[model samples]
Target chain A: MTRILVSEVGPRDGLQSIKQVMPLEAKKAWIAAEAAAGVQEIEVGSFVPPALLPQMADTAELVAFARTLPGLNVVALVPNAKGAARAVEAGVHGMSIPFSMSETHSIRNVRKDHPAMLAEIRAVAEIASAGGVHFAVGLSTAFGCTLEGAVSEDAVVHLAEAAAEAGAQEFSLSDTTGYADPAQVRRLIRKVRGAVGDMLTSLHLHNTRGLGLANALAGLDEGITTLDASLGGLGGCPYAPGASGNLVTEDLVLMLNAMGLDTGINLEKLLEVRTILRDALPDEPLYGFTPDAGPMLDYNERIAK
Target chain B: MTRILVSEVGPRDGLQSIKQVMPLEAKKAWIAAEAAAGVQEIEVGSFVPPALLPQMADTAELVAFARTLPGLNVVALVPNAKGAARAVEAGVHGMSIPFSMSETHSIRNVRKDHPAMLAEIRAVAEIASAGGVHFAVGLSTAFGCTLEGAVSEDAVVHLAEAAAEAGAQEFSLSDTTGYADPAQVRRLIRKVRGAVGDMLTSLHLHNTRGLGLANALAGLDEGITTLDASLGGLGGCPYAPGASGNLVTEDLVLMLNAMGLDTGINLEKLLEVRTILRDALPDEPLYGFTPDAGPMLDYNERIAK
Candidate 1:
């Protein structure tokens, strides 16, 4: 089976939902632990203003530290042209601009509509290109939006194509509000992949509707090889922060491994990272099935003796 | 999308595991309520002796009562020739015999080895054939057996063929001790299906390994249509008594419906059935997800005008 890359966004996505701010050292430790657990990419933190999201304030420090780890792709979430400049200056592998496809969510999340955000994405791409940093447009609410109700597939395709035209090296669809069903997922992904064939198609899905793994499977059927998952399934949008925002990384990794697909992630090692993270933020309600349920019949046994 | 059949087996498989016998009326009410909840087929009760399982002592009466309901395929579990004869005489729409592939489980469960059990199946088939009753042989321990470890794929295929030769109309593979991983499930189902292609392949899985839904998806991918689930995941082998067994019906139904595969069972009516069942066994643990997590975004909007 061709291996799939799982980007653990727990530190960035999972921690941001949590009220407590993990120490910069603890964040670095978590990143190292995750990299050792075979996580290829780690979205260490977001580049929003510290005043807005104190939890992600140490993003630059964490990213700089993460870059020292060999073979680790450190990506950061940049909200606009300013954050994109910071990510470029930090010299990470890639930076993602949150491109909201829903008009309402775009106005609420980034205070800009689709066309204006596309302009920012184009500028971010130019800045990243100048610095030789990869640019990925993370399109949030490609699935339906809670604020806007149902997001159009036409809107999603149009945004993805716009990002590609704006010089984005890659594109990923996020189920920010998690209203995606598998059929809609399959339909939208096919449309987007057709619009941007080889410019790196990926998905960032949430299990809000309990369809994270199902949506991932649909994307897989559409030839999407990269998937975004948060450890313990964390992350709540400021407007609607809840337990349903991001897909839990441990559960997603478990599904892929159980499907006989190599994810380079040892579930045992990955599960341990949750504990390390929990120690820093004890009140965080960590979510995942495989972690709490334990391994499916001695996954450790096969790995052990 | 073909509306997949989800046969609720909580009353029979789920309740039988506990020490307390939900009174005869409770079993009848559970059957009627689940039928009212749009569950098309249900294994209402097993025809085992009251001496062996006092919890299901009133199964015969429940079966007779369930038969009066409109459009319900009431099924009963028959461990040996005696139970099958009793179920057929009681006028059930379907009668299923548990044929353990493991010599150890067969010896423990029914006191008959594989071939001897084949003789018993043929005996029941002859008895049911005369009465024009539908017969299904569930290949219990088709995936590894707890007592007799590593049940060979050939042994499972052999039992499936034996049951078919003995004149059974339907076949299902159980994750008896919940040892099935999806890859293993896919392999065994393929082998069994190749042995009896399109011979009414069903899946009887457990959440003991926390991979029940994942295993169900594997079965669906392999073309096994019918899924057996217990409401609230109330199940454990009554052979030991007072322990939980079987996958939760609520979780399983939610998973299938979420994946866009239509299961005729309604989530709301299913929850209502649980309430009525709760009156019978107040302290008994009834498990399910859709009940706990509420409906998905605009579930009623999706359902209503």
Candidate 2:
């Protein structure tokens, strides 16, 4: 069976966009439940300043709690070297920094231009390497940008080369604006792979325009292994304007398992974890069709049969 | 440009599952607006008995009105020889009949088993041939059925062959219960084609599990051309329990156009058509991401750039 790494980014990304912070206990329960459900990787939190995003203020605590789960790959987002240092100190297994492909978006998001962001990535790579942590640079807005519009494919390839040269261990192409389609996904993945070889293995996609799963399918066709998704697709990035939730984790897992790919996720158990979020964040709307519709009637039979 | 035939099925499929009967004028307006938006084909309505589905009672009237539009290939669903005769009299450019792959679903949907359904297909095919109306057989529940779990792929291929032998001019695989995944879609399309050759050209998928577009992408990968979608994913078949809605047309067209495929659909004009359905069916809910989020910022540049 083909195995795909489904990286859960709900606790960090999903909570980041919400107005109220998820209670720490609820966060711990969500992470533990997901880990128990065979989700091996979880982006527990971001090491950003608490002042800018209070919802992520409890990220370090989440990291610590998630790390206790055996076989769980605890990961966090680090926007700069300062955040990278904090994440390393938090003892995260992996750290990813968003490298916006659009210079305009890069400045607005991290308050750094391309050169400065590259330097920061270098600095973070050094810190993560020293701390024995896996570090990845996420090419955010790689598809297109709302602020700048039409981000160039050449620029994305060039930046991947630069980031790889800057000591980035792995790369993730992010459709932060949900502007990606399957055709672009297939073409871009091949182009970036041409630049950085097999380092480009992950994809961070959005469903704002309803092509998230389709784009992920394209990524899979190009041999992308790790896919980032939020439980219920609850989060839209604050920095990416008009962006909606990341691909719904439940839906993505459902499709993966249905395709006879082993995601190691027991979908029913993963679904139960949603109740914690529901009770904790009562007003927040959870999104995903598989959860609403439940698994297909012949869930065990698989789609191929 | 890779021209894709986006056959709008909202008038027939969308209305079939709804509770309230749409006014004839509203249906006319919806069909006309979509045609004006450059949609070349539309399944105007079903020719079922009015008592069974009053929502489709206006199918003949719709076919008459839709045929008036230049370049519009007006179509309707005919469940039996009687309905097929009526569809022929109504002068539809095309007519389709649903042939459920699962016998349980077939019995429940149309009160016909495989052998009986084959007879019905032969009778309707003769009528369609005599009347010079283009006829298609939609292999409903080809993916899997709610009534029966794990529909055999061999069964689907066999039915397509049987239908073809019965004079089905063309064949379409329908995910009536939305159990299809991308891998299964690619596999089944190839298998059915092995049995029926290139005559299997269209896909009628449901978005129940959020894999609708992904499955469509898989079909596209296999060179399947025509895609069936509803205007807003508004209707689902009342017969196919647990089935939600057909693939949303607005989102599908947006993805197709974004991928640089010529769908001939002016998305902005297509979005305008939703207002007619919204106003005419005040209580009905409209579903689609592109309409809710509008098109991407760089909608014109296409994803490849």
Best by TM-score: 2
- Judged by lDDT against the true structure, how good is candidate 2? 0.91
Clashes of each: 7, 0
Q: Give candidate 1's TM-score.
A: 0.91
- lDDT per residue, candidate 1, B1-305, as tens digits? 86788998887888777777788877777888888888899998898898988987888888889899999998989987888888888898888888887789888877888889999999989878987888999888776666765677787887788789989888989877776777677788878887888884799987664567667777887788899998877876644222234777876777677556778777778877777767877887776546755555543343231
Give lDDT tens digits, candidate 2, residues A1-305. Answer: 88899999998888888998888998899899999999999999899999998988888888888888999999999989999999988989999999999999999987899999999999999999999999999999999988988988988999999999999999999999998989899989999999999999999999999999999999999999999999989898888778977899999999998888889999999899889889999999899998777676444564445
Cα error, residue A162 of model 2, in Å, equals 0.7
Lowest-scoring 10 consecutive residues by lDDT in candidate 2 chain B? B296-305
**Tens digits of per-residue lDDT for model 1, A1-305:** 76899998888877777787889888888899989999999999999999999998889889889999989999999998899899888878998887888788889877898789889988998899998998898878776676766666776787788789988998888878766666666777777878887665788887764557767876776788999988777775666443265877888888778666789988899889887778887877777667545455443342222
TM-score of 2: 0.98
